[model samples]
Target: MWTGNFWKQAAERAVKTFAQASLALLTGDGMGVLDVNWGDVASVGALAAIASLLTSIVTSTVGEPNDPSAVRRTNP
Candidate 1:
């Protein structure tokens, strides 16, 4: 079952990754750091969101088998 927790976890991961990436870039640039483009950040966020959406959709649609027989039928 695709619950609220699943979505929340995905979103949290995306945000955390984005923040870490941005921070790394900023620190790497040193004192002469150039402006961080808003568009670039948006793109990264968008990609992460898309990935999470796709994963949720796929898992929700193709759920686990209900019984042991069902699993065996598919596997064997």
Candidate 2:
């Protein structure tokens, strides 16, 4: 979590989560595009992103110390 690479990966995961959440909000229902609630979409996206970040932090303990995304380091 202290390393730049760890932060970078966390941010990437958050952004991806946000994008996916937003897309789901936009397309999941039969509502027309114009009827979509932008505020709700943004809120959901933000929440999902935060959740992703939290997940990264929680999982960091088991991974390589410097890599938040790595579950474990393998021997060569």
Candidate 3:
């Protein structure tokens, strides 16, 4: 997790999670896009981002040392 690549992957995951969470909230049951509670969306997004970061940390040791999303270490 100390490598720059790992951090970049973590950041990307967090941003994607935040965007998805915001969209889910905006489209929730009986709610129009304009009816979104911005504060709630932000809170959920932040929590999702933090979870993504923690997942990245926990999985980092199992993959490529420098790449958080890698499924296996390369033999280069």
Candidate 4:
């Protein structure tokens, strides 16, 4: 289950990840911006990595706040 905070964190992480990875092209390609090749598989992989990080963060965060898992854990 996902809390509102989880989505919020994921959104922020994805944006930051995209920006950082895209900026990396500037240094590597001397393009001063995201290079065209960045639109390739590596970019998609980076996005997936970002999503994974979000999921992990949210999973670890579970059972902390009002942790939506509380109800399920008690019932099961």
Model 1 Cα displacement at 9 (Å)? Answer: 1.0
Best by lDDT: 2
Q: What ranking emerges by lDDT with the best candidate at the front?
A: 2, 3, 4, 1
lDDT of 4 by residue, 1-76 (tens): 3577755655666666666665665455665333356555367648765765656565644655533222235554
Model 4 scores a TM of 0.49
Error in Å for residue 35 of model 3: 1.6
**Superior candidate under TM-score, 2 versus 4:** 2
Question: Per-prediction RMSD in angstroms?
Answer: 7.5, 1.7, 2.3, 7.8
Give the poorly placed runs of model 1, Cα more than 4 Å off. 31-34, 41-76
Clashes of 1: 0
Query: Order of all candidates by TM-score, from best down to worst?
Result: 2, 3, 4, 1
Off by over 4 Å in 4: 32-35, 41-76
TM-score of decoy 2: 0.87
TM-score of each: 0.47, 0.87, 0.84, 0.49
Candidate 2: stretches off by over 4 Å: 73-76
Clashes of each: 0, 0, 0, 0
In terms of lDDT, the poorest run of 10 residues in model 4 is 66-75
- Candidate 1: lDDT of 62? 48
Model 4 accuracy (lDDT, Cα): 0.56
Candidate 3: regions farther than 4 A off: 73-76
What global local distance difference test value does model 1 have? 0.54
lDDT of 3 by residue, 1-76 (tens): 8878789889999999999987788776468767767899999999999998888899888877776674985578
